[model samples]
Target chain A: MNVPLDPKTLVAEMSPVSTSEHIAAMKKALLKNIQRSAYVYRVDCGGCNGCEIEIFSSITPVFDAERFGIKVVASPRHADILLFTGAVTRAMRMPGLRAYEAAPDPKIVVSYGACGCTGGIFHDLYCVWGGTDNIVPVDVYIPGCPPTPAATIHGFAVALGLLEQKLKAETHVEAAGETAALPHPDIPYALRVRLEREARRMAGYRQGRDIAEEFMALLEGRAHTPGSFTLLECMMEAIAEERDPRRAEIIGHLAEVVQQAIRGEAPRGETP
Target chain B: MLKLLKEIFRTGEATVKYPFAPMPVCKDFRGKPEHKAEDCIACAACTVACPANAIGMETDTAAGSRTWSIDYGRCVFCGRCEESCPTSAIRLSDDFELAVGSKADLTRKAVFTLADCACCGKPFAPAKEVDYVARLLSQSARSAEEADRLRLTASTCPACKRAQDVHHIADMGIARQMTQELETTP
Candidate 1:
């Protein structure tokens, strides 16, 4: 005899597994009076394992997540908390669901890392489901590329309701007459651009901007102060005082650019 | 046992009291990207440079406003946003305890008004950005008249600027023709 099968059961459903109201109440109760150690079972939904490394380090002697009795277990059957990592790739979705199902009712789900929290840089990829919350109900999100061990501990505390979350949603509206202050208004715009470009070329962007700002401040201070030393002499003195050879060299290059501007000479390789 | 206990005492505690006491992060630690909206021009440089698309800007032409938002969950803490910011308004701070119970709490937003184009009277760029550019150009201008011209150019929309350039180029062509005719006659 031929058997008829339900097409709905045959096809893999894309909908997320929903927890019942009873389970939600139990989970809330569990969170409220969780006196025992919460055993965490890490489910790798298709992670790069950066989060795994950080998680392991959090349990190490330095961070010592075990101090709060947060233990990482190998089996989902023994888990009170299911820690999901990665963006939940298509192939691993079933396994992730399986791990979630294996854990007993009232289990807290923690979405770990940038990938697990929001699919990170790979959110738009074709094969990934984007985030753990897309596949399961996430109770807590520990967001970082891979959170530092201390951050991980903080996340665990938040998950266990032992600590209050520090981050709150904020929105700022622009007021009337709001204006961004021009950096180094004392320096000529052309000279400022040239100095910043030279400094950025020598050092990286963040450090370069910092160095340029410092150099401009020094220039402005020297100009204001009635000193016998000329601008060039002041720069040389500043460079001599700089302990770091690398920073000294960058400052020297910036000074040369300033000298070029003063003398009406074009920069070395480019036309005026 | 006594010797082991003494050795342990000598070594001191290695485990940090993190949640109980404030954890000290190292200097230059890349953690949270704090956006100072007061100093931000909403230039969209950080939005373009973001590899994760965590920082985004939504422009509402009808409302004449631009909304700048950053989702901390999607941010990789790479500091690219901090590096690409023109006004140094976005900087990475040491506030890394960013775990949250809800996803909505992970987002930060800023709303800025758009500036009307000087020529067209239509909203083109953010008001703060236009003001900043105008001020910068005027600061570098050689003469008062030149400063005024530069400020006008900075405030004009890109489309209007292009149209003005074309008209100016046509006027220059007519002038060049007149000069050529006069030189040939002489």
Candidate 2:
């Protein structure tokens, strides 16, 4: 899985320039072609802006990918690569598809994070419409609720390998590290807890008709008696099982209670 | 091609010898905020100006406005705090080197000593700023009274200081800034 950029035997891009006089002019053109070939455009369908922020940090001073001639362009039409973030919301689906189509042939699409990859944990929601692969051909799928700048670069390194076949790179140049660029001496405990919680929610598979029926049933229910609640309330309550643990530990507690209840242990009471 | 290969081999390493030697980041880059407590008059202006609610004045009711806290964790580093400080008390510095193990650790705080006003004999601004201004206006005994009377703060009742917001001062002492004439020569 190690792919490296080897500039050796670089396709003699100038057709071997028949005469010695044209050699100097030919060399300049080849170098220009090498630099012109790398262009990436980032697209956010409806992301919460976490992945976008991380992606922005990547191009900054610390991870400066411009060193490798990779540049971030604004327009999708002029791009050679599509770096997509967010779960494909219903509104942005068509525009996202059009953007992918507009990026000319021989373009690479990188699914930027867990949200873009499998709809992440927000898939069960009503607003989210599709995962990344539904609309475009995704070449690389980065895993994480909002993949770090390092993870984004790691995915990019993989994409470069697929774009150009090559042997091992001599120096093991790893992707960007945030510790050096970040001001703080340590990753805040709050952020760590938040990211870890997101990791747990994106665990289940999709169910088409059955899921819709259950969801509609939840919407269509009304129970006024004791020990009974509306379907939406029940669904909202059930969301604990599917909730991304980053913000609150409430759903995680419910899931833990359910697992404990099934295991025949007396469920612990909620925090006051 | 052979010459290009030789050039590549001869090129120095790209990686910076960081930790041991840090790379110089661009000036004006928002990394971290540095506060100068000496200049800060404890106005709570930075707190009110901060859009993110990341900066605020934390104080006990009895102690009055004691400490100013800037939550770097929530701060967008918008520079609004620095921009709004009338005394230029808060200034953004090049030192962006901030990292924390906990969110609470990111909050920067400053506190000042309290002092009573020269005229009203009431608790007004911080001891040092009040003393410094008192010393400066000693020449014009009336200006010291003007400064003390006009020493407005959140504690100052707005109703009483309504006219004295410089209009009264202009009529009594300093002249008001000129209004533009209809036909002005540039």
Worst 10 residues of 1 chain A by lDDT: A1-10
TM-score for each of the candidates: 0.93, 0.36
Instruction: Estimate, for each residue in A133-214, the C-alpha lDDT of model 1 and write its tens digit.
Output: 9899999999999999999999999999988999999999999998899998989888888898889888988789899989
- Name the weakest run of 10 consecutive residues (lDDT summed) in model 2 chain B: B95-104
TM-score of 1: 0.93
Q: Which candidate is the best by lDDT?
A: 1
Candidate 2 per-residue C-alpha lDDT over A1-272 given as tens digits, one digit per residue, 9 for 90 to 100: 23344478432221110223354354334334544556889889888898888888777766666655568998988887788888888788778877877876567677776577656556556766535765665756664445545445555655664222111112111122201111111323232223223333332111222232233343334332356664336645657555445322444443343344345564334222
Give the CAPRI rating of model 1: high
The residue-by-residue lDDT of candidate 1 on B1-186, one tens digit each, is 999999999999998888889999887899999999999999999999999999999999899999999999999989999888888999999999999999999999999999999999999999999999899999988899998999899899999999999999999999999999999995
> After superposition, which runs of candidate 2 have C-alpha atoms over 4 Å from their true positions?
A1-272, B1-4, B113-186
Docking quality of model 2: it rates as: incorrect
